[model samples]
Target: MERSTGVQAYYAESAERLGEVYESVSFEDVHGALLDLLPEAPARVLDVGAGTGRDATALAGRGYTVDAVEPVAELRRVAERLHPGSGVTWRPGALPEIPGVRGPYDVVLLSAVWMHLPPEERPGAMRRLAGLLAPGGLLLITLRRGEPPVDRRMFDIPPEEVADQGAAAGLRLLRTVAEGADRLGRDAVRWHAVVLQLG
Candidate 1:
């Protein structure tokens, strides 16, 4: 699948700025709503779209083995430098077809990443994510809710849409957190966490 041109251009140009912005927030603060759903430490994790290694490094600190998949070279470089010796393996890949990364992870996280996928790519991405989960593993997808930025490609995907697609992929919808305020202080932006389990 072709990547969104806006996503490519924007991240490439502003990777360092975005990295600083994203790393400023603690992972726990951002994912507080779904903390209860996380499996205990030592569980394998896949952090897709791990822009700056913030989430992946935090999970590593908590003793989870994390493989962070990021498609952008600039972001990956920034992430690795920001969290050296973090024990988080950086992989080059993206959604719908995460090339070079094989998984049966205990947890798969797509934080603020789903919105980047166009509508036509969602189903395939959902199926691919489901396929990467170990039996009974959790798939935590955080959906961004807000207007798309004029400079970058994004969609305010609804939780219902994710849940439906997950179901079609044979995943059980375990939980859906109500939309919460954006941690970045964007007035119009909010977030919803959708948790699914592999049968």
Candidate 2:
């Protein structure tokens, strides 16, 4: 799937920033989230918009078969280098149309990629994402909710909006974990990690 102009810019900036700190970002939260959904053994996992392959590589190392999808060429290259011989199938593509990876996957991860999608495209994207899941498969999404960047090109949706989108996509919400705080103790930059069961 061809990305929109806004998505291209968002990815370009993320690639640049991630290149510098790709190795340092903690994967504990991501790994724990995935493990919580698939606790017994290795399962087919799809890491959507897998920038730098941090989560994908970690899952592969733990014996899971991961299909990592990244649209940016530079990020794909970085992921390849970091996960050499890690058995991770790297695909060049964006959300809703993952190339070379067929699913029905046990888990589909959309970490930190939701905000990059334009509001108008979000519903279709969510439905397409849910379509990739196997029966009883889990769809894990991490939404960053807060003030939008000054650019105003992206949509910073609230957690309620995220839940609504999931329902519209035929996904049943299983749980939600929200965190982060603003200056006055109000939640700012809320990281809503939601679990959904595919219908």
Off by over 4 Å in 1: none
Range of the 10 consecutive residues with the lowest summed lDDT in candidate 2: 179-188
Alpha-carbon lDDT, every model? 0.90, 0.74
lDDT of 1 by residue, 1-199 (tens): 1267668778979999989899989999999988888889889999999998999999999999999998888999999999999999998888879987788899999998998898889999999999999999999999889787887778888899999999999999999997678898999888899999999
Best candidate according to lDDT: 1
lDDT accuracy of residue 141 in candidate 2: 79
TM-score of each: 0.97, 0.85
> Clashes in model 1: which pairs?
none
On residues 1-199, what C-alpha lDDT tens digit does candidate 2 reach at each position? Answer: 2376666666566765665565576567444544566634578888888888888888787788899888888788877877689888988887555556678888888777877777777888888888889888888877767776655355677767878888988889888876453212335455667788886
Q: Which has the greatest TM-score?
A: 1
